[model samples]
Target chain A: MQTHSYTSRRELETYHFHPMVAALVPLAFLLLQAFLPKIFPRLLILDLPLVAVIFFAVARRSPIAGTITGTVIGLLQDALTHQPIGVNGIAKAIIGYAASSIGVQVDVENLTTRILMNFVLSWVQSLLLFLIFRYLLGLRDTHLVWLHELVRASLNTAVAIPVFLLLDRVKLRE
Target chain B: MESFFSRFKNQLVLIVILLVQTIALAVQVRRPVEPGHPDAESVRLLRYWASSLMTPAERISTGFGHSVRGGWSSYVGLRNVRAENEALKKQIAEMRLQQAAISEDALEGQRLQKLLDFREHYVASTIAAQVIGTSGSEQSRMLTLNKGYEDGLKTDMAVITPDGIVGKLRLVFPHSSELLLVNDPTSGAGVILESTRIRAILHGSANGRVQITNLTQDSRIKPGEKVITSGGDQVFPRGLAVGVIESIVPDPEHQPYTLITLKPAANLFQLEEVLVITGTQPNLPGDAQQQLAADAEKHAADVSAERLPSIHDGPATEADPSKPTDETAPPANNSTDLVPKPKPALHPDRYSPGTAAPAAELTPGSPRPATDAPAVEPVRKTPVAPETPKEP
Candidate 1:
């Protein structure tokens, strides 16, 4: 595992992305996330924006760029909802920064790593939303449905594997 | 100092971004956009920007999808067409029968209302809007309509379908608007159980289920009983179908009220189009009201004589105390004769439209009113005055 991590890290040091791809990919994911649910309601369980954020952050491998990208994408996602814009923004920003920082040390390109990353990040997002809602906004409307969320996390991971593979082609590598 | 600043710059950026968002959230929560207020206009402007950017794409996509689906269904889906058409015909026949019965009842209700001088409010004009998109989040349940301020839609206007109410228009943009669905956690409506007519507040839960709250535990509400808008909220018109009670359970909080789950009459999840009520008019009395009044007058004229005090056929002011009480009886002087006068036929002019004469004057022996006297002939036989016996 250590040897594999060193090799992927060395590869990451050389990896880079086109700026337009960085911008448009996240926007496309946001649009799809918003649009697909209207066609098939069951698709509501999949958080495509979060998947895009994780993919971008890990691919960029720069904490600062990942944080900024997450913030912009999160706010855009917020714009599509009726919720307070910042809740998703804050959560995604944290996820983006952490994923990129960890990406520097691990091989998130592995399918298993990608799934585990999404699974853990989904819970983290929900927890942060709960805290912000309870402490900052004094809202109690969102309940912690552990089982539903677990299923949602697994679905997000499953979707991420294929979506990331498609996105990888569009990504420009050094 | 320079090394320290460089080292913490990324962390500082994250902190700054988070702080800015936090403030934005706080500001939004502090003065949330409400319908009709000028302060809320700012929020509408923001929504307008967002919707203008998004809804055009949505419309194009939906239109394209519909065309594609339509083409496929028209040619490739012909196998069940005949069976479906026959089923639809049968359904139409059944609905026509129901419509006839309902129209009869509505006529009767209108007649009764007119008799009591009751006024009603009815939808005067409405604009049809297509459901283009949703709020795209579970936290807020809302839909976007294809009509907006240009279409004369304002905030707080009622939106409904033939089956039931959808919701109220919340935010209006130039070309589109947002509707807060009735099942959102923040939504509440004054609803009445159709069976018992007991009123309660219909509240939306976070899980997208709606329930009746504030009904006393003793209230007998049956499952499958319909719920309707009470017009108490002044948002939806009264008597519009809302939903049906699905179940009644004790309040989990041990409160005095029971909780009732409801199945919405409108297919909230599958809405395609809705009617936005633009204006309402006061319902004026129709022919039904006039017919009711005429019938009442006729009834009163028929029974007036039996209900009034009897008087001799003379001027109403000058009463003869010795006169027999019954209109048919002859004068008292004819005690030996004991013969009664012939009863008069009912006068045709006795009861005219809008005129209700005093009951005593309507009797057979009484002279008709001067205006009607020329048209009425006295039909009763005047008894012959008893021949004087004084000479004998």
Candidate 2:
């Protein structure tokens, strides 16, 4: 066996990857969400990055990876753009941790089981987001608060079934 | 130990966010043209950099939307070509008649203004890009212009058109910029009356209309008076075509000041191309504000008189109390002599051309004190009796 200098990073002979890629995965979805709408205009949907984050959280047995990724992506969004700094990072981290906690208790074998868990996750996320927007953001009588919840919940729930089944092709377990 | 680092890191993030947001709010809530504080540059830079990527994309989308709108307008124009042409011909005829009255020498004076050399006053140092898109959120209004630092555009440049003022630059980036439309409440432009030469503080009323507030009620501002900048505000050079004062309403509730309603000569919804002015010199237009009022008076007469109440310069008295306010003075006149004697005119604006008939029925100002002026006190006591006699 070759002696390794780095403990955190390793070359994979099979398909197992480091957790950072798992974190950066949502970045692709985010860029796609922002870009696709401009091109097609009508296909613009909601909660792409968040949905991806939740999916990875449940798929990855280790909750630590999702939480770390969420924090990184959140900070990246804040730095790259003009938003309240750290706000996104905090929200994403919390989301990641929550998703992973739920994931830890669930059975990974059944396809329908994953979909139901995703549906429950979407509803809980939507509700939490609405409260955060209303109180923390002070968006009273704001359409965005209700809109974020309703639109994201429905869209993620619909999108969740397909994504979970497809990712099921590759097992992500110890 | 495990929880401590995580908690501390989270706290640090919160602190940083709070610090940045406070700075942004402070920078934005300030007067234009005043060179911003040191922190403002960073905020501007941050906003520009953050929005830069989406700016071009936005501009393209906005441009496409505008093009679609323009296409729609042209389609509408084509549909109504016959009637529109007839109206245009009528307007052309009016112009021709006006031309015949004014000397060719005078017409040349207006058209010959070297000040109008758009190239010099505003060095059209354009970055040669188009508007990509526009997006507005509930928190703020913004326009995504494709030109930015790459186009040599900076923050606080004045934006206008051949028609008049539109807005000023708020946020800029490497590839895009944002514009503030004239109707935001926070948006202010210092303007001068084309008439009395008095300066009025113009504010956007959040809706399309603009409010020129805190002007003294006694200001000789009249309807249809033109308003322009007085070369004082550094943000907008003096004498740009800001807007026309459509109506001047005295705020009875405000006590001591009047709020004038300003309508921008340029319709933002109808803009295809615009001129961005860089010059700081404000030149007074030898404009015919007096003439506009005369023409508008005729237009006003054609409109039904009742609509004037809303457009009436100043807030309407909202009291509408049930209690009477001393108009109950009874006429001691012989039933045959209820006619009121004519008095001098109260206000010219209050008297319309249709006043010819009403002018006959009641004299302006004095109806010869209605003969019952002294007896009005007794009439108040016997309100029922006055009606009984009038019924007789």
Candidate 3:
């Protein structure tokens, strides 16, 4: 078995990313978040995208690519939201990089590890986004977005094991 | 040498891309999809082209997509279509109910306009122009329109809507023009109570009602009294319906005038269109002469300015370069923002400085506002509440 480590930018770029799949789930999360309030009426600030972002960073193991993904998603989010430009972008980038760094440093290559990592990381991401948007950016609309993020993160963590197994095709790989 | 060539090649590509994007963006910005934007011509052209080119498959897909969700909704929405149809039928009935009322309103508006037109038609040779754009500012309500010198619009010419007087012409361009709405803080209308014949000054307000002030307490003022432009100055024809006097009250200073409140007939927001009455028909020959002079003035202004509109809507003012201009008609000094949008079919050659955006010049008629209301009154007036005396 070749114990290969991806260090070059080209190697990273050329790698089998399945960009559509990687980007699609977060977009689905965004769509769900948008429609959920209309359908459910009671659901507010469900941070499904935040959870999906964390999953990309940890499971995908690509900080740079994750940051790029975050930027595009951030732009889309900004279009949907009234927040100032670059606020969401910076928050998303920080979340992506932080999650990627954690995955690299730790020996978290299993289902349980992925789930736990997603749970913890999503909370951190939510806090940072709230802090930046609320305190730094001076947009204190409601405490709901952060709260919904926490609930969504937990929900995401619960499904992490099954989703990772499916996405990574771990069972087939073995 | 090789490195330099490669660098130049990359730089050239970047520059080319930037240049193309800039041109595209400028065109796109000039004619936004919205009404009052300058690029309405483009929007119309695009819509026409798109409508013609749309494939049968695409139309099918769109129709299918809409009905699919309705058909498969969790409740089996198709099953409830009959009840849904009933609700829609009820709505249709209400709409039918309102249709007569609306048509009556339209008829009234037409009559009012015709009356004003009959009077104005003989004045400055008025060209009927539509109000195409409105400045978004609440304090200085200005309207940009699609007619100007090309359409025989001139400064000080009267503009009016179906409801009542809009405002006099302020600035003129070849293809577009700007009018100061009557509600601006700077706006003052010479008006009189049609019922009492007591002359009172009607002023516009922040909230959407006109207030008549400076009336003596001795003067009897009551609600439902008709107010009209006094026409003492002979500028506004007398007996034009301004609004009814809503109330009367005593002032602590014992000011003689009661605060008479009136509502304008025109719902400012609902007006997608307006008419510019440019004086009378006999004035047309003189109007043509003055238009020549204005064109000359614009030419001089263009020569002194650093640049002019990059694109041409039409060759309406192609000979303007030869016209003589007033050397002293000062070029607009160091404007903080960009020039008004390039007006096409409206003014074709007009430029409203600082009031309109680049996009306004290109679009003639904006779509009706997306809101249930067109605008919260294009002109906001405040109803002066009469301070009733407390009976002992």
Q: Could you arrange the candidates by TM-score from highest to lowest?
A: 1, 2, 3
DockQ of 3: 0.10
**Model 1: pairs clashing at backbone N, Cα or C within 3 Å:** none
Given candidate 1, what's the lDDT at residue A56?
84
Q: lDDT for model 1, on a 0 to 1 scale? A: 0.76
**What tens-digit string does per-residue lDDT give for candidate 2 at A32-135?**
44444433433333556666767666665345656765566554444333233444555666677667656655553366766666666666655554454455
* CAPRI quality of model 3: incorrect
Which candidate number would show the highest TM-score if scored against the true structure? 1
lDDT of 1 by residue, B182-275 (tens): 8887778888777788888887877778877787776467888999988788888778899998998988765776888999999887777899
Q: Write model 3 residue lDDT over B149-184, tens digit each, in one string.
A: 777776666666656776666556556565666654
**Which candidate, 2 or 3, has the higher lDDT?**
2
Candidate 3 residue spans exceeding 4 A from truth: A1-44, A60-76, A79-82, A107-111, A140-149, A158-161, A170-174, B1-65, B70-392
Backbone collision tally, model 1: 0
TM-score of the B chain in each candidate versus the native B chain: 0.69, 0.50, 0.39
Winner by TM-score between candidate 2 and candidate 1 = 1
Better of 1 and 2 by DockQ: 1
- Model 1 residue runs over 4 Å out of place are A1-11, A14-16, B37-43, B76-90, B115-119, B284-392
